[model samples]
Target: MTDDLLLTGARVLDPGGGRSGRYDVAVRGGRIAAVGADLPHRDARHVVDLRGKLLTPGLVDLHTHVYAGATYWGIHPDPVAWYSGVTTWVDAGSAGAYSIEAFRRAIRDFRVRVPVLLNISAVGLTGRTGESRDLENCDVDLAVATVADNRDLVAGIKVRVDRETVGRHGTEPLRRGVEVAAACGLPVMVHIGTTPPRLADVLALLRPGDIVTHCASAIAAAADGGGPVSPALREAHAAGVLLDIGHGSGGFAFDVLEAQLAAGLTPYSVSSDLHARCLYGPAFDLPTTMAKLLAVGLTLDEVVAAATVRPARALRLPDGIGTLTPGAPADLAVFTVEDGPFELVDAHRQRRYAPRRLVNDATYVAGRLLPPRLPEPPRPWIPLTAAQRQALQRRAGTVRALLTAPLVGPEGLAEQFPRQQAAVPLDPAAAVREPVADPVSEEG
Candidate 1:
């Protein structure tokens, strides 16, 4: 209830400084007052026990579409933010000069910190194909003016270099995006997938601080046919081009990611390209994307750094936003690492079982304590119509026979019938339920 609060007994992990230990963090007037084990909570009006939780800087998602009701692929930020341990949502090219005012209006009352990347295209992502196909839409002067007008909210420029988005324009759109970013003295975050100008060409044009998102996309061609970790990419990384994992529905591929990691090409930041389509499956949330990285051999500390400190530095966000340092804003995420047989999926539909997953326990924004978004309570099975029940029984019987049949080993089970294995309930009666409407289908 009070602005001053004390979080005690948390395993404090500040990946920014490579510090990890149990500490008591005190907050007052929305800023961190002190952080140490012996800090007295006598002056604090509110005290929270975080004994079993890991407390780190508030998570930062560098790539997201939070312009809900404004963009077709956008979703509200708060629901995905607090729930996934993110306190900062960086809108990645969801709004351009045309819609940025609406985007700004939408987030004016939001609790989460929203910094936007102004799209190069004047229309942004309002169309079915994308915002950059027409050369007319790539208005450099308007974009530069927009960034100047909204200096506080605008972080950088965003451009998609994929073939489908840019069409015959090739790297011209990227050129315009870079020009606007240069004029505004900001970094440019380029999205690369199916490339006509090639990923190497995109990389060559980017400056040191510029970011190439979806670096692990399988659609990206290797510069020298060596592997997915192209020679140009390695050179670009050396020259300071930041590589970001914008794991959207079609961006991340397990094979490509594994190869890149194996070849020592670790991403500078990890972000869920959280839009409508990928929000449910594959790219579930920022935490899930981090879990996928964990599954692929990134250390817990490494993964935390990618989601926190690294992204903050990349976006040039104000200090104290991504660290639990004393005198910083009291934005924190408390999580518990659950031991698991947890199944994680990539954008390519490849599955990997992680030994552990970080589950958010609670979050604190500014100095306000917020509840973690909990899973919905299981609904009671709705009684099915007689015909529907009979159909379900028959379906269950067929599945049971297939699961028990010879040649359906563990490998075959996962490979051959992935969807059926995950979908079927053990009890046939439980399977005969009414379909629930998708929560995200309708506009807010």
Candidate 2:
């Protein structure tokens, strides 16, 4: 194929500059040749019209599981990546030291850019059981050796810190993981859920550049007393800890996310923790997760930054990978922002209607056009099973009584649902303040 290709008449969205306007982007020798209005058509060997579409840098999903044949939770990367406008997919702790070689062998032929976070546990996500439950699986020396051996492929270390995964180990596993990360000179991506170590303790062990995935989880007794954004979380963010939306099954809660957004604790990166269970619903793909964020309150530019530029920076990938500037890699995605009365559901099954949602139109990787996948029929919300419905009915009875009682305003909200009120911003601008220095520049 010829090296020259041109995309004309599209609204180019540059999240880095916070700008969007009609322009043409030229590609040659697998890099952006030029981006401007009305470049001479004669300079291009081939051209495609993208009228009425939005073009931006190809997306990067920092947290995903694409070790496919090697791990239990793995899913193939290409189907979810290129088709959904993602050119780079970072596998989050799907394969540990023991299985990483096999994982590497399996993905040798894949076209998408795949970097991995080595799991702290040697076995990784081998089975249904938690990788860290045994503690012995967390072999630090072995992890260091593996990272040293696979420097090019391994971006960081990953550890899941939760009640089910780490159990009574509390913060011990996290400390061990952090040690290994320090030894290898890499960052650690910690998965947070219902905690025994408590979110504060986990944050304490983490250095400035480390990542906290699933920051919006709504399981019982969250870090900030079940509030959307906790004071400790704000402190962690201020201290330079990066938060990610690892929207996995049971990870994202609409109520929790809304409160966090309102409080100004926006995520540093947006990723779909796309695994076997979540790939079909809730967290369908990176674009779907981006759409959910847009539905909540983020502008299109903000959402694109979370998916593209921010992720590339967080992963410490080369600078040009997530930008559309001249001489950068010609990885681009086109999307259509459709008006919607669309029902968007979170991990908790709480539903919201969005007036607009983003849909993928086309994708280009390395200046080569990739075939688009047929759109999956929309399945907004999963059907509630009988047992779940029955339980909800019981809870509804309790809520019904409260609703019938005299309604109070803000005080009543704070009294009945203190977590939500606690998440509300006291100073809206301060709550949503940007970090003083770029968190992406810090070393692990």
Strongest candidate by TM-score:
1
lDDT of 2 by residue, 265-327 (tens): 889999899877677677878888887887788887888999888888787887478889888
Which digits, one per residue and each the tens of the lDDT, describe model 1 over residues 1-444?
Answer: 343888899898888756799888889888888888767767788888888889988999999987766666777767666667899889999888998898888989778899999999989887545678889989888888899899999999999887789988889999999999889889999998775777778888999999999888876744324468878899999999998999987788878888888888889999999877666556879999999988888888999999999999898898568888777788889899898868888877789877788898877789776653322211123223476457657766886687687965576655554555555447776678887788788554
Give candidate 1's TM-score: 0.82
The collision pairs in model 1 are: none
Predicted structure with the largest lDDT when compared to the true one: 1
C-alpha lDDT of residue 417 in model 2: 50
